[model samples]
Target: MHDHRRLGRELHLFDTDPLMGAGLPYWLPDGAVVRHVLEEYVREVERAAGYRHVYSPVLGKRELYEISGHWDHYSDDMFPPMRLGGGEGEEVVLRPSLCPHHALIYRSRSHSYRELPFRIAELGGMYRSELSGVLGGLTRVRSIQLNDAHIFCTPEQAVAEARAALGLIRRAYDDLGIRAARYRLSLPGGGSEKYVPDPELWRRATALLEEVLDGIAYESVEGEAAFYGPKIDIQITDPAGRESTLSTVQIDFHQPERFDLHYIGPDGGKHRPVMVHRSIIGSVERAVAHLIEAHGGAFPVWLAPVQLVVLPVGDAQEERAHDLVRRAEARGIRAELSGPGHGTLGARVRAARLVPYQAVIGEREADAGCAAVRLRDGRRPGAVPVGELLERVGARAGDRGAELWAAA
Candidate 1:
């Protein structure tokens, strides 16, 4: 229910075309950069967390989901099957999640107990069938690029993996200046109709969840879990009392077994491994929506697309301004030259659209070969070498590390 209309329009970050099938966001040039910045940051963080990245096809064979228990257990969340070949014949579904594919990958190789803990990360674009009323802007959408990972490990390794995931989540939230966030310790099935078959496994799973949650003091309630597992949700409550879950770490005891996945034990005997499904930043689209609302259109210098715009005060200073632009570009700074959009130097600075930092290069500053750099922080680092300014932005980028490894 947050009003994103103003930010969406003013920033020109996203466009929702009614004719292009609503709920799909059209990322304008600037918006795409923001998206890439986030995606790159997250990929780097996940790579450092002992995760091996993988790519999977969006469409899957029907048998794959059937063996993974997704077809029978969580059917409501998936998009309808696409019929391939000659007629309305064979059924193949657009994957709603990446667990089944990752399961197939594990089964593809015979794993050993030494590889007991294997994490696979995939930045996959998934499709879902959303209710009509729920589809609007980026909050609820039909398509999403998700930070999907599946951790295969022995039950004993669960706690360590879960703790590491929590640390990453916290780091991300802190870097983004996200406060007022907490974890919802999702309990295992409590004999409700909301839960699935297999009561004994549910009890064992809940016990595992309790063990992890107790250590973190994560508050939990019953019946909040997926039919197959217990999960920890990272979320926040806004001033309007509306709550949103941004990330999830689920301990699944059922899926691996459903697919009959196993690893060779030290005894050379076959043993089942547990699966932990997680998304630290959840969906890129939804996270952007959260940030758009949370920061209220003021992205930090780290994530800003066009960090600075150089405006030459007069025609005589064009060469100097262009030189500064090249210097900023070399440092990976998204800088631009202000053309004839504004008549006067003062007007150009005032009308610096979609750009936070504006450097005014007149005769005096050009002679000094320095940039009169302005900060989005409301202070100007006047007369600075382009290299010095790049160092400052680089430091800020490192500080604003992605939300996945940090927490939502």
Candidate 2:
């Protein structure tokens, strides 16, 4: 089995230190490049889909979770409150979730019926008080950067918004080459204190999710729902055959009621709006962990940290190789020059096998004003003109295409 934790270390992707604490792995430079690219791709996709990004503080007052019912219903997973003063001081805590702060943002201003579906997205951090025994690599982290979003819409618009969120999730999965194991309609279990004590609210929320999942194949799993409501979870299987949720779309009425969020209807009357929560790629850490295994560290061209590496066959072609690297970088391609100092040309190419593209510059090819192009998949397209080569690679990377080369 291709394990992400092992590959992560072998590839210098991430590392965990005792002082940094368990369940907190820091990304190496190359890993940070991959992460930054993925985050930018997500932001672009969300921006195109009409999601307005926002920033919110990671810490909130202790009473904030109390009002959101998290303190009462889900406090066990939260960190102990940090008292500011010695005697009877105000308390604050690292937020376990971002929805409460988002609710406050929604309530910050008045809204009209025309702005029914006010979508807000954030690539924000949150903390969880996970036990050390449960801590692993990126899959279970104490500090998580979530690709979270919330939509406040009228009751009539809830289902449609949720369906759109699911569509976005599928688009992201396709782009990232993620294959979901299954789709699950997670419902609340019977007589569980972990869940809110409101059958009618659960019923209404479950119905909304069911409608959102209409005609979509999904399994109804009890006790898998969020504390506030039912959700549509997009499940993925790891190399160990362990199934976990990677993406989700949920309908929540509880938070709206708790926050007393409302909008002005066409009749100029105050109307309660439903909150739709969704995560396209879920946590960045878990997503990267799965990707490390999925691609086995051989990422797609657009997502590869080092998209192209230029290898010089001999000292005579060193200048040409450097020029090629410069040109490639100028074209916005992540390229590096591997000269004789690194070793033989063959050895250099082998070392850069994980890179998506390799350009070999030899005396003959340099004289001919072209270079031999090789793909990570071991396809040799022979020697091509230098300008044409960079253009093609840049275009492919820009389009985020799965294929290395465009059609003739």
Candidate 3:
């Protein structure tokens, strides 16, 4: 397997500058393209799944986390709080997770039991005080953007919401080419102080989680759950056989109680709502890193930064090259022109292995109003009409086609 860090640098995906400190990466244009496409796809999926996306601030008062218990339990992983207005204002910390923020949104509004299963989603950027020793490319970083969401539902709808979240996770895994993953039912250990102090609550939450996991194949692992509640962690095996948690569907019984999140029930009484925290591609950066290694930096056409490069055979075709690139862009394709002095046409084409397709524009092809299309997979479908090229490429990208050549 290719090392993602090395490939990331070589392909201009992302880099870390010394001035910016460690564990924080700057996404280059190419990397940003992948991230943008992934985010768009995720938003579409969540929208269809009845999730309403929202934006939240990066920093919140210390009390915000105190209520969520992160200030007490996970402060070591969080950045130190900052005092605003000469130490008179509230102490604020960079938000570590969106759960508390989403909870606050739910609490800010009045809802009936009919709105119980309301889901809020966000691609929130977060900060963590990760040790420099553990920092690696995009996989492990201090600054991360998470595809996070919280579902506030009545007790009766909690399991259904959890199951629906699993379906989303599975769909994402399948779409992204992630395969053969196992589910781990993470629960609190017996008498562990890391977990909440309610035994009955833990039992009831665990049983609900079991009901969801029992419907599917999973292994129960004690002590692997979050401090707040039980969860199901999706463990994915990379190409190198290394397993890592790509996503999670967690049920939080403690936080709702702590934050007093509630809705009016059929009995006209306020009751605590259950919060289900889940993420399909937990961290956007980590997901990109994983996919880079999996595909050796040759991202799918839809996710590729420069899907097609126009290489002019000579100065005679330079204008035509630029023109072709313009036309491709007008058609909503990411295309660029390669100038002379870099290398021969063949050499430039070969150098662009990371790009999905290369179109050679020369006098013969320009006169014929066609392009010599070459696929990354060593197949050259000679002299295709420009219109046909656009149709094929656009369709593949629009459909999020994964192959270099759909017909191939």
Candidate 4:
């Protein structure tokens, strides 16, 4: 098994400093690029699924969580509330999840039944107070930026909304070539005061989630549900065969009631809207960490931080290499040139393994307007035309292709 923490340091992906507090990681430039690309891809997917994006404050008034029932159940996991001014000032806690803020947004304006299944999404930062013993690397951190969304629909529309969410999950996994080992249907256990007091509501939520899960193959696990409701969790097997949750689609019955959220029906009657909570990519940092380990730091071509690096053979070809870098960038390939002085071909190629493709431009190849293409896989496609190389790489990235190279 590849140690992601070691890879993280060696690859300059991220680092944590004691001065900055624990469980907080500062992303290096290379790692930041990967995160940016991943966030963009996720945005496109969410946009296509009819999710309207929004940005909400990272900290909400303590009363907000109180109304959402998070204060009672999840407050221990949240950061201590920040008290401003004197005793008169209200306390604000860093949001542990986006569900309540989104509920408030849904309640901000009146919605008719026609607007049912309203979806609001955000790539929002959250804070939690993880125990020091469990805090290790990017996988378990106090600071998390999550791909979170909440769907507010009529109770009658719950099944269709869940089905739509499952479809979105499947499409995203297919795009990234991620196959979950299995699905886990997590339901609330009885007699847990942490769960909401409404037994019938729990039954309804559990039934709805089970109906959704029954349509797909899944295992049932009691006592794993969130305080609010039941959920479907995707369990991904890492390269080491350890299963971890990567995403979830949950049915929340408690939050709507806690917040007294409602929408108007066709007959002009007020009815509570069901809340469906989902995290497509879950914590972005954890997802990236998983990808780093799964691919052994050799991300798929489209997702690699730096897709191509130009290695000039000698001083004579340095300018040519820089020009090619610009040309590659113009074609939408993430390209960079080696530092001023060139390194040995083998050393440069080895360093370029951190990237997906490397082009060693020497006097001969520069003069021929081509590059000796070296893929991450140990294959050298000798003297390919620079234009053709750019076109092919760009196409792969545009299509989100997984392979770096294939036999032709």
Assess every candidate by TM-score: 0.92, 0.98, 0.96, 0.96
Top-lDDT structure, candidate number: 2
Please, what are the lDDT tens digits per residue for candidate 2 over residues 133-203?
99888999999999999999999999999999999988988888999999999998865888888989999
Tens digits of per-residue lDDT, candidate 4, 201-274, equal 87898899888876588999888888888889999877778788899988888888888899899888999999
Candidate 3 ranges beyond 4 A from true positions = none
Clashing pairs in 4: none
Query: Per-residue lDDT tens digits of candidate 3, residues 162-272?
Result: 999989988987777666478899887865666667888888888998988875888988878787888899987666787888899988888898888889999999988
Residue-wise lDDT of candidate 1 within 1-408, one digit each (tens)?
A: 445555766787888887878667789887788788888878888899899999999999777778777787667888777788865678899987888889989999999999879999988988888888888788789888998898999989987787788777777777665654677877654556556677788778777767767756567767678777778898776546667888888888888887889999999999999898888788998777777777666676677777778888788888888887888788777878885545787677666643656777777888877678765545666776656555665555556643211111
Note the Cα lDDT for every prediction shown.
0.77, 0.92, 0.88, 0.86
**Weakest ten-residue segment in model 2 by summed lDDT:** 399-408
Clashing pairs in 1: 168-405, 168-406, 168-407, 169-406, 169-407, 170-406, 170-407, 171-406, 172-406
Q: What does candidate 3 score in Cα RMSD to the true structure?
A: 1.6
| Rank by lDDT (best first) | 2, 3, 4, 1
Give the winner by lDDT: 1 or 3.
3
lDDT of 1 at 368: 78
Per-residue lDDT for 310 in model 1?
88
Worst 10 residues of 3 by lDDT: 399-408
Candidate 4 residue spans exceeding 4 A from truth: 339-342, 406-408
